[model samples]
Target: MTAPEPYAPAPQPAADDGPTSLVRAAIWVAIGALIAAALVCVVWVLIGGQNGIVGRAFLTILLLVGFAGATILDAHLAPRRPAWFALASMGVWIATLLIGAVMIWLPERYSWGGFSRFVQFLFIVLILQLVLLHVRLYLKAFQRYDTTFTRAVAIVTIILVVALAALLIVPLMLGEYLWFPDIYWRVTVAVAILAAVGTAIIPLVNVLFAPKKPRAAAPYPTPYAVAPVAPQLAAPSAPVADPASVAAPQELLPWPTYVDGATPLPMLPDGSPDWGAYYTGYPTPGAHVFGAPEPTAPQTDAAHPASSGYEGFPPPPPLPPRP
Candidate 1:
């Protein structure tokens, strides 16, 4: 009883740690990369350089733009977690670009066979990733809104991009000459250009047309009114009586008795008048006066008074003995 209880630490409230500086810097870096790549690719396309380098650069720019748009949209509009689709797309583009740069430097440094084929395979993979990334971005942006025309545009755009990407990437990757062998690379470049434009435009459209959230309604108060009550009047009191002048009470007359045979009234089993039996033709046995003759059953021949009427009728059977 004398010993003091051990001291306990108080519970601490949860800490709300927001985004760190490093994360903000990384997002800015991604955005800068996207913008720088897009500018360089546009300049390269305008200069009209070698097909191989231009196509690769253009596709890389398209992929970068798509990734950056998705990431920015998610950061602003999405929940706390980053968009996995955008992150994956960005990672793929970075890896492909780094590998391509390494391959270009290696060929110059050493004689290497199959390097071109390897680059072609990498580009093919890049094209696939770009298609998937664009599809993801379109879905993310248009999913929240109720614009039918915009969604339809997105669907059609995605389908065309995939088909064009396939047509351009497959033949070159497989070393097959199916159609338009000379301008095949140009067609692929054109498709990449279209995809980049679409990626840029779709998000802007979403931001412009997105539905605004409705405001909350104010609460209303209900009023109650009470009615006024009327005042009640007291009842008048009776006059007092004089005790000495009060009249003597009169004796009550006796109830009248019914004389026998005075009127033809029906009687009940307890000798009370049965008014119902008197009105009805079929009277009860108690309705008859005492010492009166009992009524007999009517003969069928006497009621009919004709032998021909009784011809078709059968005779009545004898009654059973009483128990």
Candidate 2:
């Protein structure tokens, strides 16, 4: 039977926890601020008492509160939205105040000195808030994007370029206003021109040298391929010997497995008495002429002729007769 295929694990979705969400939130906030500013203006025109300092002060407070609220929300909750939020807040703050100032001036209802003083105070407050908020956001941006000296240097260069453009553009735009001195006009025009030029150059410079967005590293290189080794040839085996050609030892003497070692008694060489085996001196029957039996016992001394000295030494007294 064929084997079953192995199972694979499923992949998970990425988390939504970054700048894009904040940017979206900021856009909504800006839209809300625009609506609020329009509503306040409508309320002021319809309500008739809009001419009083009390009414203008209340409206100013209301709009400034909105700006502050949007700033705080953008800074704290949706920092990626800061640029757009800040822009919206500044636009609303500046446009509403400028329109209100012009209306007060044109009607010539409130004393010009009094209105001017109030407007100057209001502008100071607005400028302070804008500077503080922008400073905070800029610092945060710098900290997030720049750690190395090179990164900081790049950031400074971009800031200087933008500043130069502002210096040149603002003065020329306000050139015809007479109350402002020629010196002020010249400075503003110089700032606006320089800032504009710098803005143009910065983009090209950034495109050429800005750090590229980081991407995830590719998965590790594929494992190296190994070449298969050839199988080795085995040596030829030796031939088997025949079993029958080997000899077995006789049953008498003990067999010696090696030339130098002993074995069992049955395997030893035979040495029997009937085969004239040598031991001590003795004779057997001579089966020859005269057919004499070999000497059985002793022959007494012939020269002595039965001498008495041989009585006790008759020696073995003739051995006991054998059957």
Candidate 3:
């Protein structure tokens, strides 16, 4: 019987392929609009936002920008991202826009100065939060397409935007008074510009000072060891004198232990301390002889024959024969 073919999974579509040209063009258009809107806000701030209408105008413009950014973000990420992810981000965006708009409208309709001050602060906070969140999202999502130049530009732009937003703290403190001092405004602007320019050069610094990879050491050249010619040893020459001369003593060395060292020497039947059975003569060398004064030539003397040779002392007297 023929074997069955293995199962194969169906290929899922790519993220880029999921969006049509029209949708992509729309995304680009939205991106361009966001850029243009940012430029307009910068221009407005530069052109002396000291007018009495600054409160209403800036808030309105900012809220509209946030709404557009949030909407575009929903479209940009939804196709690629999971449903829950899209829903969560988009929901927060819309919520911020709605709350800000309602807050703005309530103060205007009621003409409450104290309430307006509160709403103004609330409004500033909301706008700043939305701006920071959206910028973070945009930058993070587009990292795959980032270049060195684009990254540097983004860093500089972020610094400028944050610095500009900081100027609002002064306006917020003034609260419905509509009085922004010229020196403070000029100082804030100059600082923002200088910071943006200075911060932008960090990418260049990274390029210049990046850590270098360490070099691999060359494998130390191993010289082939010259095997010594073993001196062509002359057959070791029969070890000079005789086989009897270098032969080990017939009694092998004793087994070693601490007790063995402390034990008294074994006595011979004749009551001498036996040095070893193989010892040649009584009083083996330094010992004085007993039967005969001199160590009588290691001879087989009938009565006291050369047998168990004591190391030093002469053997004690033999026991009397049994009756």
* Candidate with maximal TM-score: 1
The Cα local distance difference test for each model comes to 0.52, 0.43, 0.51
How much does each candidate deviate from the true structure in C-alpha RMSD? 29.0, 37.4, 26.9
Candidate 1 TM-score versus the reference: 0.30
Error of 3 at 119 (Å): 19
Q: Which stretches of candidate 1 lie over 4 Å from their true place?
A: 1-113, 176-180, 183-186, 212-323
Q: How many pairs of residues in model 1 come into backbone collision?
A: 0
Task: Itemize residue pairs with steric clashes in candidate 3.
Answer: none
Number of clashes in every candidate structure?
Answer: 0, 29, 0
Per-residue lDDT over 203-285 for candidate 3, one digit per residue giving the tens place of the 0 to 100 score: 45445654446999985542221112111211444554677777563432332111223322333444344455224333344
Say which prediction, candidate 1 or candidate 3, comes out ahead on lDDT. Answer: 1
lDDT of 1: 0.52
Q: Judge candidate 2 at residue 88 and give its lDDT.
A: 50
Per-residue lDDT of model 1, residues 1-323, tens digit only: 67855786767989865444544554666666666656655665567555356445545555665566655654454235445544544454444444333333222222332466566756777677767667776778777674777667677677778777777666644442235566877777787777667656667776787777799998553221111210111144375587578665343322111232223333455544444433332247645332224433323455654233346873432111112
Candidate 3 residues lying further than 4 Å off, grouped into runs, are 2-69, 72-160, 166-177, 206-323
User: After TM-score superposition, what is the CA distance of residue 54 in candidate 3 from its true location, in Å?
Assistant: 23
Listed in order, each prediction's TM-score against the native is 0.30, 0.28, 0.26
